[model samples]
Target chain A: MSIPAIASTRNDALASLLDNAINNKTKPLGSLGMLETVAKQIGLIQNTRVIALEKPAILVFAADHGVVAEGVSAYPQDVTWQMVENFLARGAAINVFAQQNGCALHIIDAGVNHDFGPRTGLTDRKLAHGTHNFAQQPAMSSDTCATALAAGMALVAELDGNVVGFGEMGIGNTTAAAALMHKLTGIPVAQCVGAGTGLSADGISHKQRVIEAAVALHASATEPLDVLATFGGLEIAMMVGAMLKAAERRMVLLIDGFIVTSALLVAARLQPAILDYCVFAHCSDESGHKKMLDNLGARPLLQLNLRLGEGTGCALALPLLHAAVNFLNQMATFESAQVSEKSE
Target chain B: MSIPAIASTRNDALASLLDNAINNKTKPLGSLGMLETVAKQIGLIQNTRVIALEKPAILVFAADHGVVAEGVSAYPQDVTWQMVENFLARGAAINVFAQQNGCALHIIDAGVNHDFGPRTGLTDRKLAHGTHNFAQQPAMSSDTCATALAAGMALVAELDGNVVGFGEMGIGNTTAAAALMHKLTGIPVAQCVGAGTGLSADGISHKQRVIEAAVALHASATEPLDVLATFGGLEIAMMVGAMLKAAERRMVLLIDGFIVTSALLVAARLQPAILDYCVFAHCSDESGHKKMLDNLGARPLLQLNLRLGEGTGCALALPLLHAAVNFLNQMATFESAQVSEKSE
Candidate 1:
């Protein structure tokens, strides 16, 4: 898929709603802290009383990478497929979070090495059981990239709801995501790679070296999607697609940690339209997330030193999104509540 | 209220369910991280195919203290009421979080020294408008303490929710919380007192001295509640009551911030059963919370350097609780999914 179209926004309406909400609040100007802006934004977007959050949704995508055998990830390649099974079986962290927050969870097999044939539960949208090794060559060809994008858009089309979250599971995906983030954001791969699944200190160094090599191989690519086709796993490509669809649908995109954010960066680079709906779930303890978030100018909802992937960060963020929506919809207005502001 | 009871936990049933769930999953043991135990506990309690989370709630109790006049807080008394208004107007960070997480917010007027009246929208449960200056004399009388407890318990009865959170909005409350925790934990007030609203280095030193003096004033108190009744804010007493009722109802208690945790310490001392239902929402950057958490053997889920209260931590925790229920219900059996798992 080509870049998503940047939709026109009602700046006047959003600005007015923000300005009105702040002025009407009982607190001194800017005293409500981060919440002050959230209320305003919600008020602007929904175009009415921001009340009642409904149909929270979490989207977890899983894929495989050739880099797993290179010792970039702490866990083995089997862990990715194992976690996908866990997610489908509703035993994963994201599954638990989705349940707790009243979110309908949908897990997609974006790509993995093994066939999960005849499985009734898994959303089998695999784009070749894992991609070509980035160490030797591009992860997937251009045709596979288009197929992955289509698969992502398909998932979002089916699950349009109040908020959409993107979570990922892959053993060596961090090396893959960091490489893509570097290609799109112009940050070096070393700055973007992190311990994917509990990598040792030495494992991180090896992962860094692997990422640098991949970046070195793909340095001359001019286009973002081409870079993704070069180093992006099916999960990353699919996440980029899902985010675009969420943007088009005007759904809030709850972005998980490092790998997901790297996907977000790729999606945003391809289509600046996506940034409007994106909320960084957390600044992962992973070293690369900060630079990616800073480059995207994203403000994450949590900073729990969390590096657990599989959309756990995104699942955690589900509550914050509802909070934003609830305040936007609920809360008595200055006139309705009949509360007096300070002397000002 | 009498000391409360914990949920009738079928620990054996829970352990059995966990064994079955993990054995059936497609991953090795402990691959799901903290979520594994969480799922088993949910299965035990709900005893169903689908665990449902409902009645998410937060109690943000606001007040002011004469201690602020002594410059114990970095912000003025006005900010206390101002933040309360922010909470009521859904403009504070906690408000946004509460709204996002589907946690019903109940901001109480425990004693802001400002007349919220019946029309103020905040539930007017004030105890003497505000406490007497704790530095000079006891913050409140024993009768006032009883009244605060009554107010918190009454609110719990009215909200009738599945989960409860306790947070405070008094400007100088942290100083009082620190002094209380110091007395309870037998730690020095200097170690417990923290910067309440960004105190300068000189201001922190001065605040520590003031807390030391207050602790000295209360050192001879015969009992915990008596000490609290003498020096704690009306809101703190009310939280003890609120927490008691929450535990009695078997609703999960989400403990927030330093001041609120101090109330938990008081309530738990009065009845240890209340401790079983509590989930420490966060460790505030405030100096006291870490010590309080450690004393309780409680590990907080978030550590965002947040000092602003109003049940913000609970609001953030809403999603994790949501996840806990989902995993208990949604995961399928190994036979059904045909997934192979490693034996422990």
Candidate 2:
């Protein structure tokens, strides 16, 4: 899958608008909190009063990994199919959170081994029955990685909605994500490992070793696309494509927990501009995510002890994003409110 | 001014209704994220479907403390009056943030030495010209403490609207707050001390000794009322009143920064049920807040290195709270959406 070409904007225009907002002199210096920063960015990106309303949407791509067979996950590989079924049934956390936040849910079946038919509310973009076992070979083919990215970009273009988020579902995806982060950032997998989805201590060590083994195999692959082919999940590639497209369109990306952040790291390394389009939804209790966030130099919107995936954090964080949009659109300026300024 | 008396509800209806929502069986168990928890809690709290609309309001109580005369704050006491002026002009972070988030704001003159007589956007609840310099003597009369709490209670009783948030605007108020927290939590003022609104190292040491001395004097005082009168600022006393009243009325109390939290500690000791009506908005970068939160077992909603007060953090955080409420109210249940169970 080709990364969607991003639309170029005059950074000069953005800079000027940001300056105007910051210099408006309502409160004392730097008093507006993060919204001050968020507003300026929006003004620069949209280059307008912003029309304020952002459509909330998240794409959760699910795929089975060959590594799941290695017992790295607390849940069985069968649970991936089970959870996908639940997602389609709209019984999952992401589904409920989306409903609550008035966000749309797009479930992409990237490469789950189980066949989920049309009745399950899924979009079939499966590249293979499942990824190749990293213990034996590369996780996916380069072409398959490309195809997944294309699938995600195509969906974003087709949806034509605002503010798309990225998330993933698959037993053992965390192990894959941890491996991917190590590949992209050159961080050690052990440092990136944690008790994913309630894995026990033994489970964590096993998972870490599995990830280390995968990283050891994929160490020399320098190309982002090649790295994805070797170690990326179809779901992660799809997420990268989706994230790129959203950035190109200047839509907000409400990024979820750990595994997704690793995918974002890959996407960012490929296209550094993509970082601006991202909004981290939460600092996952998954310890690795904090490091990932630090390396990315990104601040998340929430810090709840959330470890569940399926784009639930994005759904949960949607309302806050909405408020950010609302405030930027509505608040009266200091001059209009006729409030006094602190003496210069 | 009279302390607003909060009323606790007797409905087992919310509890049963939440229990009903959890067992709906259409979604996977624990898939809905915080929205599900909010929905369940609200169902239990309201005994019906949860409905949240944006009438979010912040009452910022401004006062001057005698401690400022001791040169404890980085900025002089006049900044309080200046910032209050900034708030009314809607240029302050709280003003802009509040405006951005679609929340109404009321600036209350609880005990500021400066005059703010009946501005269009301000509520005058002046208790005293300012408390006596606590470095030399008790900050307030215990009766005045009762008066401030009564005033807070009174305001909420008239709030025939939506959620209520409390923030404070007082130079040198932190010394009073940290002192109160030290006495209340039995942590030394050293752990509780921080650079409030920016204090220099020597200024901080001076601030600490002043608080340590105040705590020593205040430690001998018995009863919550006695503690409030001896050590608390008028704005803090008012906030304590507001929190208790809001809790009694089942109105959400959006708590802000270190000083306000000290008032909350006072209210919580007075009525432990107060915490249920509260949402910790943001953990200020102030070191003491974390310890206070830990002691209270409270989790703040945001933590963006915020140290500015005047309810700015709460204002910035309101949108998130709104998001939480909106998701719970708007998301459809499994039975309503015809979604199947995932355990299938």
Candidate 3:
């Protein structure tokens, strides 16, 4: 299947109007800081001065990673499906945050090893029962990877929202993400590796060695899609597809932490303009996330030192999006309020 | 008038229980970062494992500063009452953010130079028409300063919320804040002074000179209340009182930008224990705010470069407070979710 097209959201005509509207709001020039930038970006994306974030949703894709057999993760592989159950029961951090921020959350079982047959609140889009162990071979066949990508795109097409936040839940996926980051960015494998779900210092060292070896083993897989098939998890690949489709439809893509960003790295490689539609939610406390964000030239909105990523960052940051849009739409102009402008 | 006493929120017995409850919440230990810290702080403040932030509110205090005559700010003094009118009309940045975040907003006319005369949504708490210009003399008499503090405490007492966010609107308040910061923290006047509401390089230099002279004039007033009487705006003095009373009542105090932090510096000095109930909302984009926060050893929840102080930072940050509480109360435990913890 062909990747969806994402147009750059840069309209010089609309940019001037958005800037004028934002500047005239009873605030000192640029006093709202990053929020003003966000407002302008949202306006540009919508091609209008009046922007509204309607029916926001977070899509959390869950799967398992064969790399857990290499002892790269601190948690057992079973936790992936178990957490999917927790999400379905609305007892996870993401569920609580999504509910608090008035976001509709959809949990997708992309390729978990356990069978959670026909569960409510769990969308089944399994590409396979997890990818192959990359320590020994490619994580997934190229055909399976393509199918996962297509599945992700199809899933997003069914959702109704102008904004979509991408999150993931897969035991050992961080190892898969780190490997992808190392191969795609050409950053050192050690720099890409970090403690996944609580690793010891020695465990991180070992995980680094595993990713370095895998990256070296797949040296011929230099293309983004090729590298993704070699190292990316099912959830990560699916997210790449969802992100592309969302941007194709001109929806604001709220990007979460490390693993989710790794998916974005692959998606962005295919469609660099996809960056125009992305809103990085936060820089996670997880090691390498800052570097990953820097590699993408992304400046996230929040830096809360969060690392437990079930889209908690996205949910926490949804209000800032609402605040930005509301300020642009609702705040009185200096002319309207009769507030004095800065002294000449 | 006597300042209200604020007790330390330290409860070692309850701290252990809160920590235990937080650690078991179906995620890696301490992965929630600042949210975990905030949750623990709120739990300790409420003295319960079950925490709820009830009826959150943002109180915006507006007053005119006499220091504006010194040309230390970029806007005219009339903007204070104009912004107050903007707030009453629900057409300000604070109004938009507060409404979006489900925060009840209260606009208190602490002492604007213009007569608002019992506006519908504005509280009548004017200490005077405006403050005496601190560049020439003490901003207010000691008696007036004391009355402002008492009025702030009284105002908070009439409110129903268990949380209060303090914001200010005064053309020359940043000058007042700088003077207070320099005197209290012994930070140099040059370091404390900044571009308030968009001052030029020469305007900031002039501001620095003006504040240096005023600090020298008020050098004899070493006590916190005395310094406040000498350098504080009526709105700032009122905020100092409100913060102290809110802490005394065990309510969470959401502290905003430079002006708000100046009020906090005075309140914290009067009752050092007030720090326990306070949450630094954001480190503003204004120069010296990070230094001021550093002096207080505060790690703010957001760093969006926001400098517009109408409690917009507080309104933006209220959702994080809600997220923290919701995660602590709603997330499933590892045992309950049947998810495996870190492997041995």
> What is the C-alpha local distance difference test score of each model?
0.72, 0.74, 0.92
lDDT of 1: 0.72
Per-prediction share of native contacts kept = 0.16, 0.14, 0.88
DockQ of each: 0.18, 0.23, 0.89
Determine which window of 10 residues in candidate 3 chain A has minimal summed lDDT.
A210-219
Winner on DockQ between 1 and 3 is 3
Q: Write the per-residue lDDT of candidate 2 for residues A1-344, one digit (tens) a residue.
A: 45666554347766776656564544344544555566565565565645354666788899988887777776667767777777776656677667756888888888888876675567888888789888779888777788788888888888756678887888778888887777788788788888776677888889888888777776777788788778778788888888888888887777899989988898888888787777788888776999899999998877766777778788777766655565455545557655444331
What order do candidates take by TM-score, descending? 3, 2, 1
Q: What is the DockQ of candidate 3?
A: 0.89
Residues B130-208 of candidate 2 have per-residue lDDT tens digits of 8998877888877788788888888877886557778888877888888888888889789988877656687789889
Off by over 4 Å in 3: none
Query: lDDT (0-100) at residue A310 of candidate 3?
Result: 88
Best first by lDDT, ranked: 3, 2, 1
DockQ-based class of model 2: incorrect
Model number with the top DockQ? 3
Better of 2 and 3 by TM-score: 3
| Candidate 3 clashing pairs, residues 3+ apart or interchain | none
- The alpha-carbon RMSD values of the candidates against the true structure, listed in the order shown, are 6.0, 4.8, 0.9
In candidate 1, position B104 carries an lDDT of 78
- Best of the candidates, lDDT: 3
